[model samples]
Target: MLYFIWQKRGDKPLNKSQKAEDQSISYQDWQQFFQEIESKLLRWRRDLHQYPEVGWTEYRTTYWLGQELVQLGYKLSVGKEALVSKARMGVPEPEVLKQAENRALAEGVPLEWIKRMEGGHTGLVACWETGRPGPHFAFRFDIDALPIDEGKEDGHFPYQEGFRSRYRGQMHACAHDGHAAIGLGLASWIACFNKVLNGSYTLLFQPAEEGSRGAKAMVEKGWLDDVDYFVAGHIGLQPLNIGDVVATTSGFLATSKLNVFFHGKAAHAGVEPEQGKNALLAAATAALHLQAIPRHSQGATRLNVGKLVAGKGRNIIPDQAFMEIETRGETTELNRYMVREAKRIIQAAAHMYDVQLEIVEVGEGLGGESDKEWVDIVQKACRNAIYVQHVLPHLQAGGSEDATYMMRRVQERGGKATYMVFGTPLPAGHHHPCFDFDERVLMVAVETLGRCILQLT
Candidate 1:
């Protein structure tokens, strides 16, 4: 049994050999740990899948995780307490946030837990330290869902198993549910065997990674301020096999996520349509032109206006409109150009429509370029796992992740960082309505991460 009380924080005197002996663990021990925690890990993943919440609105998710950490005697830094305010970009309106909270309440989320994550904050860090001094190590896990309806057909595993998302129109279409499960499982593992570690470790449950939002705030707060190594991985991206893991991967596009609002005077459309500036028309116009922006020849570029809403009635001239827009490029320089052009087009549309315009830069994700040296550490870690049949040295990461922001900060300060792709068999592609991953992959990932923490730190 693991003890509730640990020796203390900070360094304690110990001979080199004693420290080495303390850190040692055999392959048999790894299998034993996996068997002990595997079932509970799968249960956690199912529960999370049933109650998916979108970015910045992951109130229940954070509370669920925070309570578990406390039970394990882990010191938790939560919500506004740990976040840096100025670094928070691309946030939704106060009303939109309030509505999401109300829905969570209606769905029977615990009142006390909801109260803890009241603001638009949902990320947290759980830290643990052994008495022996060593380098600081960190692992990040994203804990947000997507805005898609869950497929309730018989073929969908969630529906068949009765774990479909309770909140209608929102689903864990990505692997975040699996990711969080692995994160919490690993936390439990470390707490149970806390004495084996020489260095301190922190697990970062990040929020709003879907739109490349929410990570900058954590970085700005100096979350990665301490010494040494960092690791974060995603499931079912480039690695499609059940046991194949990608040790080193790059190609995360730089992106700008923007939310724009157009305000104008309302008037009856039939009686005095000219008296009102058409905010709806302006938003729609901006959407069409935004997509038509010229693609740069330097590399790959993408532009999208995912959502646009306006107009209250058929006869009334719409007074307000809101739209979400984003642009991406292979490099930071190219992404900047796209952002500049997008702003110019938005301004021109507002001018032509004679409406007041507001554009909020809610989230950003920069292109990723990982350190080659870090790959060796991850490769060595995966080799220790019996289930990891093949370790692909490199591949393209294929999508945008706010983790790249965290990686950039760590690398800038001379600390090493690498984001990995953990393999899992998928029922459908990510962000799709029917997406699912094999529950067994959860154990494989946690065990590999455990080994990495050992060799790296």
Candidate 2:
């Protein structure tokens, strides 16, 4: 069945003449269109950066995108919810793959993937089709902000320049603003010359990536059923020169976040100390023991207690306590081991202190290993594009992403997946108050993705 689907998607080998012609046309058209859309792309990026929204609440952002799509002459369909669009690929059927290939050959640029999804109110998919036939390719972009307040004082770019977020306490601290804008820029440019693409393609604008929820929901809802190849990128604070692309070769750490609570009797410190069980003491003891959880000798492991709250009054023995904790490892088996060991230590501490204990799982993310075939394609594409430097292959990474859910899903269904890191010079590291990224790197990312799509399709 899988082989049949591959053949039907036009995964057959191309002759030398056909390949050369396709590459020539794709290169010429991309250069021309990128030049035409540069200004609009920059403006769109700035607009999104100025008014950031958090997670699933990208109301204004989604609305603005919808308006843009309508202006571009694409057929827009409302998603299951508001602030979302399920935009269809352009005319030409027999599946989107063939149409995209035909379009790429004819127009010099390829239009393989563009489909809008109904990912809550903030999700959208834009699909492009060439008249020829082939497999479906997908590129995912996450568009959501963090819960931090935007820079408010004078001298900050957003505040001083008068482009700060209208929504207080919501900002694009994680650089997702750039991601959304780049995706939109790609969509707009691709739509203009849909005649050269060889196969079907879908561009997914996902929401709630901060909470690690959106990608899984999209998959469960069948947003990737027809996708054969999937790709996504993220902006980071590494010191690599602008436009340098980094691809991870091995799996990253799998993480599980937990909240542990302990309940006990409250009493006066001096008068009723003997009658009260100290939940605060138990929680503290558990936290200390948690730190002692040995880092696995076989693979990397980590345990962190980020937050702890115990008592309100100095004179009273606190009755309740809670702590936010995380356990991580290089693989699922190791992560599970660490979690189980931590749980044992917490339970033991609670018993010793005579306090009731509860553990709640807050968020979880699995690690991902790069697909060698897809990585090679990305490397070649980056090498071919200007302003991009291909660094050495990554051996392992500690970064965690919800996109791993999408990658795993695709693998389960017999598809190829690759996640790359697009380097941008930043003054501060990720998730920091001073985090900032150079915008020029985005142009390289856009060019790299465009080239990769052309080659793969």
Candidate 3:
């Protein structure tokens, strides 16, 4: 059941070369390719949207992608092989991970896959080696959802489309579901054209991207070490038409995330007020001082104590307190300054209250800029994209992305890397309860990256 789809007027020629080999997949061929799988891509996204999983808890999502990739003849690296275990940051508690794993198993993920992904080791790297002489290209697609409740209003697109999240307090509010689907679509295209391709392709279905957590582990495992080119992209970052694409992005902030705990001695406030050590007061004071850290002179710096919890009851002095904190800077050194200053304030507050303090760094990311060479390549590739109307040179991200770690790793080794942005109309901003993007962007991404691979290989 294939359709002879024709290119619309005003579209750029997909291949301008006179070579016969370049005509192997003509513009009509790509239209047919996309037509055949468009429904499958939508179904995949809806299925993923229905059952969202968060960082370090994406067993089902991993399995869902892995099973299909394996069937596509990719040599797979799952769990420990895909990411360095000790390098994983901001992992959930052991019990929480176990519960997620149990839920995955209950939901029909095979025992074999579960065993490989036990201990919260989720996500996989799928590789296709052509055994021909060429460059190695690595592309990353994050697959973790956020901890947000989906909107159930009649006007909400997901609700109207019957794809609202089924998991309570968990939703794919950041377009990661669409990312995973696009990755799979690209994998299918690559597998179909394996005979015509050269060199190798590695697709990283990365997880735990919500807190800037995931890429470091993959980078530490040396996944991007041999990559001649690395590319990663996000959908709908800006308010742009669905056909717009940004070839390169700038202004990624470096950041560090932490969890701080205070321990003190509890006592009856009426009978033993002097004997009590109030952990609550220690944490509250630290939160205040953490915000008061001197800003760096070199660049913009930010610090926030997002959450704080303490105390047992009204009559008893609190023996424990916990805080979630983060610091960000325009540069890595600037972020380091904020983190260092916040630590000093935390330690001082703990000492002043005579309470034991523990500070655990949960996540970190480095600022990065896209390579111009690769950016040019992406811009050229986007010209062949079926849905792409305009390819912007660059956009200011003004945020943090863990993919910077992989980009740096590749660039430091003398390879080229770039982060791309596929623009799409969004119902709501990212991480919001009603976040939803135009699904047409899925095929746009698949075509854009698929063309890049074709041009590179």
Candidate 4:
């Protein structure tokens, strides 16, 4: 059902029929949708790629997407309107968050949207309902980019063409840009065909997904309150051909992101060194001990100190230092154990070095158990679609994803939910500078999801 057209590079602006590795696909279930939204999908992808934003700080991205979805005839809720304040976890300090909002305002985000999204609370929920009433179905799409410089390599397509990221140190290295495009494409389908569609539909364009930050807040805000069935997905996991789709994904590692700070009195290295309490030493010691945390005998476990910075100058006993770390485990209980041990190690290091220490959780996500019956539903839906050539029964996820937070919530309240992967060929692995995917996957995702929603409702 899927085939690749190997071609030598002789490009005059590649199009639907071309292949360099030609990462293009042909769709079956929705032909008019192909013609109607195909060009729009590519346009939306590039426009978002050009103006990338990181989690929580996705002010402009949220505003733009909100406007578009509302224009497509769906009712929209954003910022504090859709998010609960006290429920927001792992938030940056007020001033730091304000700067990001200010930057978005100066860059042209609508003031109406900006006002609601103040303090970096950026995400939205769009609802399309048939007044006659039925079960409410939900689809989630994450909308945040990574903090990496867009590759300026001349051969890179984004740079070669006109739509590369305009932001200096932010780029859509992950496929959120594509995910947003797919969500919007799916919205168009839902809006245009609502009369024929059953049940009510809700689409979540979640913010700050990079650190497992956004979904919990939405869950607490009751975003999935009435959801009867829920589905969420990512673009690519491991490598696969253009038309492969993982109908059920499990084993998203439960994880926590933490920021550690150590404070002490600074002093000159040669003068009164004895008066100084070295924070740098305390932080460095804690980092090493954190990594040496014993592996769980029960299930898989992981710990990493992704960043450590201290010391202002060579002549000073550093009085301040910082560390950013994350812990992961195959299950939620195991992750909690690692976090507990980590805190103990940090407290001991602070006492030994006579420095003040603070450990703050900036983000967190719990592991999930994919309901087998829900998997069967998604599998049957994909198998029935012409767009999917392979319907993977069970492909466990290798990384942590916050979508499970919402999934668990829906399931907790007598709802059925599952996370799937819209598998597609990639030019490079996720989070790499050259990451890109076959655009045809967007079309297939719409059709497959549409089929599933239709079947469920």
Candidate 5:
């Protein structure tokens, strides 16, 4: 029936004329419907990019998201409670516990910790029920910006035109602005065709994906309890020529972020040089040692010291130094090994330099493997929606994502998960100061996601 419907629509961008007798109205109707939503999707993308928000601190973003969902008639539950029950664990801090007790007295949240949580790192889930029973699907959209400055050039829009971010030193260099917009666009499009949906579908507008923190709270709260299939998309620079889509099959490196700090006594360099214990020397030695960590022959592994801060002035010996570093590998075991080796290097360096060393783990993400079933569905949907010479099977990605957490959890429950990489024409690479994407890919992403939801649900 689906094949016949697809043929009748005459909307196959990849394949032309099938027998006219085989054309189906249902497929044609959806094609036309999707085309109609393109303009709205574009607007949403631009609006989101114009006012990007950072992770967990998405107050205005969440408020706007909730308003949009409510306007679409979704019964809104604000904060974590609207999605799931609290985890069995209590507050991690004594100060938080006291605050929770006091906040519980107020009307907004039941506890102070919950209230604090409500203020920052807010998340929202919007559900649309079709009154028909089948598989339940969940789609996640990450809405966070990076802590980089925006690029201001003639080709760029507002930034070039002098409409930069009001909050300086913060910009959406990662293209999450595009991700959030696509999510809202998908929700609006799906809401219009709610009656035709096969089953229950939830739009999970997630926050703080940059730090891998937001999804844990939402999952523990039971937001993912009923979801049978999950999907998420990330916009990236087009490795290929313009107008091409890039999809990865496998190879995301599980990553761990650590902050290494070295402490020593400070002294005047010219007057009392012997009295100073230079922490900067220790930090620099460790940074070089980190690069020397051997790569595993079994899979890919890497270590990078991305940021470093040390010292006050040239005349004063540094009392403290800090390095922001990351380690990654193709598998969890390798990542663990890299982290262990990293710690040993830092400790050894500090010991040699007579400085106190501390290593703090900030974030960790597991590598993800693509589900064949979900990949097939995405490929089919994309092929049907646009012209393509070939559908790539699996593309390997080396970056880390919190979605890997969701993928692991779902796979443990025997559910399928897939992450898609949608191509955009960008002149610069991701995380670069000058990064930007061709907005046209926004439309392609919407159509791809919309069709996949229709076919899967």
Candidate 6:
């Protein structure tokens, strides 16, 4: 385990007469702290990038993070203890999960930890209680990779630096590796400054964020029920400078992901053309009409059939077809409208072809906005960080995030919540095969968030 308790004997205390620049931790102090921890940040990010995990199959990542936090004197809640077992969404099949578990075990994750995460329960919550009176603060960091193969070309930085993903078709194309690194860095800072801090801190390492699937389970487990302040941040959403940070965000669209299947009678295509129902045609028709869902007059609505698979051979009529579809809208009502329309179109297509249909909802999320009070608090913290060159008051996300679940849960119970953006220039757009960001943003995020926690407490 990495030693994170950075206790120095000659540190000075804050003075009322001192200038803002001469606070307890000044520019020089931040610089020194970053210098001391830069190597560990880079190491963590690179290792995670090379061995990326996806969704509820992040056994190795969960074990590694849990061990680190345990070494730092944190109390941990893993697997079903950290998430509601029945509430998890978009989980893989039992066989896929078992394969992932075996891989983690082969890679040296302990059997005890593996058993705890059996059945796709793979999230963690770490807490530190100071036994003093103050506000409870929480930070969320997503720990899942996308289902994209990493670029192996010489031009890619990870390939050039020998840290490219080792798993086929699994890569950290969304900078979740960087987010996890920043979470560990902030955890170290909290441990180092425990003497000056009071109250409690909770860190949530969420899984399956790519499809907006993880946060609801964590929230349903009551992690945010007692939170006084909650914050979550993402990296490289905008093509901004490494040190630019957005304190708040808006325009997070509500979304739903669905898996639709069609069943039909199979017959020899050439010998009995009239005896079979064409499942492929039904799926194709549904895919076409799903894209044509009328846009809502009240707000922006979107729909897509991302994947479709059907047929066994050219000589036989396909008996089964499957489709992966998604719908999004500016608000919950608008999204619901799109989903209802898509379902109607799908049912009509199945009926027209005389095929049986089954629709399964895989993921969902709600749109949310940050509380202005917490946004101002985070902005002030960003302004104080020496590594931060620009502080943006607000940003338009143009996407969906499950973090909205936690944010809404906290706000509903009279607490404050905000989603932040640690801006960094990306070499490619998110989810692309070559997606990567400037690693310097890692420390900048840690410093800004660490300061925010201190300010809140």
Give stretches of model 3 more than 4 Å off. 1-22
Residue-level lDDT of model 6, residues 286-360, one tens digit each, is 999777777989988888889999999999999899999999999888999999999999999999999999999
Query: Model 4: residues >4 Å from true position, as ranges?
Result: 1-29
Candidate 1 residue-wise lDDT, 115-204, digit = tens: 666767777889888867888888899999998999977677788878999888899999899999999998988887777778888788
Ranking of all candidate structures by their TM-score, best first: 3, 6, 4, 1, 5, 2
Candidate rank order under lDDT:
3, 6, 4, 1, 5, 2
Best-fitting candidate, scored by lDDT: 3
Per-residue lDDT for 1-457 in model 3, tens only? 1111112212233332322134457776676677788877878888999999999999999999988898989999999999999999999999999999999989999999999999989999999999999999999999999989999986677888688998899999999999999999999998887887889889999989988989999999989999999999999888777677788887899999999999999999999989999999999999998878888889889898999999999999999999999999999889999999999999999999999999999999999899988667876665545666678889888889999999999999988888989888776899899898877678778877888888787
| Structural similarity to truth (TM-score) of each candidate | 0.90, 0.78, 0.94, 0.92, 0.82, 0.94
Candidate 5, residues 94-203: lDDT per residue as tens digits?
A: 45334423433442333433453454535677888778987778777887777777777666554663445555556777877778777777777777777667787777
Clashes of each: 2, 44, 0, 2, 10, 0
Whole-model lDDT, model 3: 0.87
Error of 6 at 16 (Å): 24
Q: Is candidate 1 or candidate 4 better by TM-score?
A: 4
For each candidate in the order shown, give its overall lDDT on alpha carbons. 0.81, 0.68, 0.87, 0.82, 0.68, 0.87
Q: Which run of 10 residues does model 4 get worst, by summed lDDT? A: 17-26
List candidate 6 stretches off by more than 4 Å: 1-29
Q: Flag regions of model 2 displaced more than 4 Å.
A: 1-28, 69-122, 127-132, 150-160, 165-168, 247-249, 382-395
Clashes by residue pair, model 6 = none
Better of 5 and 6 by lDDT: 6
Global Cα lDDT for candidate 5? 0.68
